[model samples]
Target: MGVSGGSPTSRFECTRRLSAADSQCIWNAIAEIGARVGDRFTSNVPLFNCFGDHKMAVRGLVSARPWVADDGQEGGGGDGGIMMVAGYPSLREAVIAVAKKELREDRVSREQALQLMKEWLQKSQDIKNGRLDDAFILRFLRVKKFSVPLAQQTILKYLHFRNIYSHYCRQLDYLEPPVYELLKSGYLFALPQRDKLGRRVIFANAGKLDPYKYHNTDMAKAHLVTYETLLEDEDNQVLGFNHVTDLKGVCAAQMTLWSPSELGAIIKLGEQAVPMRHKEIHFLNVPPAFRMVYDFCKTLFSEKMRNRFYLHSSLEELHQSVDPKILPKEYGGTIPMSEMIDMWMKEVSRKRDALLSLDRMESQKVMHSYKPRTTTPKASNGITSLPGSFRRLEVD
Candidate 1:
C-alpha cells in the first residue's frame, strides 16, 4: 500500500493482504457503520470510508501487490505496504482546538478562570451544594467566553431558575415512567448527523405527543435530560446547536399546553441557563394560527437569540438555513427518521448511568434566596493576653 494526501486529511494505500479473519472483522465493522464496499473479500477493494464526530473520516485501503517506497525501497521487503489507520483528531482534541481559537481558552486561561470560579463559589450565597468540578465550571466559562464574573452570574441564574421551577428540574430520571414514555414517543430528539457547521440539531415535533397523556413537566424533564446527554459530547458544546421544530400537526389545543409564564421560563432557560449556544432555531411547516404562539415565544427570546430565530413555510426554506444532506428523509434528507431517532435513543441508553445521576444533583431549593452580607463582621482586637501571663486579662 502507498500513502498519499487526499482532500479529507491524509489518505493511506494498503498493498498488503490480510488474513480471512481480519478481513471479516473489517467487513463487519464497515457494515455496522453503514458504508458500502463492493465485496467483503480483501482483493484490493476499497474497504470503507465514513466521517464521524465532526469531519473525522475513517477510511480503509487494501492492495494485493507490494508497495514500493519513494526511495526505491519496498515496504516490508516488497511483500506489502504497511496497513495504516488514521483519524484527524478525537472530539476532545477538536474541542481543545476550538476552545483555543474561538473561546480564548488555553492552559493558563483555563486555570485562571477555574480559580476565579472557585473563589466565587466560596462567597456565593445563591448556589448551595453546587457542582465545583472543572468540567462543570468550564461549561459556564466557555459559554461566557471565559469571563469568570459572567460565568459566575450565569451559574447563579441557572441554579435560581431550577430553584423556582423545581417541578420541572428536580428528579429528572430518564428511566422514570413519564420521562421514558415521553422520550420513546419521538417528540423530541437530536439528529444523528450534525449540521454543516458541526452544530447539533435537536428536532421537536410539537404534535407528536398526546396533550392529555404527557404534561409540560414530563416534556421538560425529557428534553432537559436529553440536552444533558448531548452536551456530554464536546463537539456539541463548542459548536453549539440548531433547534428545528416541526409544527406540522400542532393543534390549537397543543398551543395551550404551556401557560404564558411557563413558556417564557423555558425560553429564558435556553438563553440564560443553558451553557450551549443557540446558533439558530428553524421552525418548519408552521401553520398560520401558530404564528400567534410563535410571536409570544419570540417576545421571550433575548435580542441575540431573536436574530437567530427563523420560520420556514416549507422544507425547502428550511434547507436554505440547515443543510438538507444531514436531515432525515421526511424533512428532505437521505437518512430515515426512524434511524435518527434510534441513534438518539441509543445515546440516551449509552449515557444511562450519567443521566440517572442527575437525580442526585442539587435539585432541592437552591440557595438563591440567601443574600451575602456586604459588610464583614469585625474581629475583636481590643483585648489581648500578655505573653507568659496565664490569667485572662480584661481590656476596654
Candidate 2:
C-alpha cells in the first residue's frame, strides 16, 4: 500500500465519496508505474495496497510522470493529454498536488514548509548547501511525506555527512588525477535520458575497474561523487532513481582492496545520508564462480535495499526486471556504456572548477559528537554543544 494522505474533511451538509471511475483510474496509474519501473515498483508496494489516502498520495506520485500514447499519438483516459499516476495532466501539476496532499497530512502548509527550510539552512553550521531552494527542500519534504521538521532533520544530517567527507564532497576536481582515474575507469555512470517512468538510471560497472591501480576506496568515493553531482537535477530528486551494477569481473581478490570500513561508509551513504529515492537495483552479468563474492557482499546491504536487489544471470534474464530498451548495448540494449561514460565525464569536466572550490569552501559548523544537557540520570546536568570543536582534537 502506498503512504496514506492526511485526514480528509467533510463539506457542509455533504461528504464526497469515491466513484467507481476514480478507483479504476488509480488502478490504471499503478499499473502504468509498475510497468515503467519494470515491476519493481509493484513488487515493493506496501502490503495493504488498498484504496485510501495513501493510494491518493501514490496516485499523485505516479501522475508526476510524463504520459504517452499507445501508438505515440495520444493514450487512453488522459483525454489526449499526459496523465500522471494521480491523474494529473502534467508532472508539475502532480508534484503540486502531492506537495499539497503531503503537507496537509503532516499538518504543515506550503508556506510553513518553505519557512522551515529557510530556518534550517540558516541554522546550518556545516558547509552551506548552495541548493536550498524550495524545489530542493521539496525533494526532502516529498521523501519525508512533507513533514517540515523531518525534512529539516534530513537536510541537517546530509550536511553533516558532507562536512566529514569534504575532500571528496567539496574538494573533488573531476579533472584531477584521482578523480580522472575514476572517470577513465568507467566504474560508474548515469544515462542521458530517464526511463519510461522518469527515473534516473545510474550504473556501476563493477568489473570495469583494474583493482591493482587504484584502491577500492577511490572507487567508492568516485561513485559517491557521481551520484551527489547528479542530485542537482530536480527531476532526479523528485522522480527518484534506479541503480544497476555489472558483477562480471568482481572477485574475492578485488574485494580485498577495500576495507570493511570503506564499504560500510558506502552503504551508509546509500541507505541514510543520501536524500534521493531508490526505487530499484539490478546486479547484472553475475559470474557463476562469484559465490564467495556474493555471500560476503550481500549481507552488507540493508534489508530494504536487499529486497530491491535482483541478481540476473544473463541479459535476457535481466530483461524480466528492467526494460532492455533503456539499457546499454553491452547488455543487449540501446546506449553504449562507453558513450554514456564519456558524456558523463564531460559533465564532470564542466563542473571541475566548482567541484575544486567546494573543498576550499567553509562548511557549516557540524557537531561531530553530542553530550546531552542531562546525563540520563548518570550524565552531566549541563552539556556543551560542540560543532567543529572536535576538529582540533583530530591527530593526523
Residue 7's lDDT within candidate 2 is 29
lDDT, candidate 1, 1-396, per-residue tens: 222224222322221244456555553564443223211222123333332321112233322222322223332111112322123222233445678889998889999889889887766655556667676678788898898889977887677666667677767677789887777777888876555555678888877866556666777788888787776654466767889998777655443345565576567765798788778888987777567567867899888888998988888888888888767798788877876666566667756766556544453346445232233222233212112221121211
- Which residue runs does candidate 2 get wrong by more than 4 Å? 1-111, 124-131, 350-396
Minimum summed lDDT over a 10-residue window in model 2 is located at: 372-381
Question: Which tens-of-lDDT digit does each residue in 1-396 have in candidate 2?
Answer: 122233222211111244557645764666665445422232236632664554544444334333332322212111212323335434444434544553352334656777877776776665454465565566677677667778867766666666665534555556557667777777787764555555667878877666556654466568766766666544456666788888776644455454455556656755666777787888887665665456556788778777887788787887787767667787777767686666667555544654455444344566673221121111122222222321122211
- How close is every model to the real structure, measured as TM-score? 0.70, 0.63
Clashes (N, CA, C under 3 Å) per candidate: 3, 21
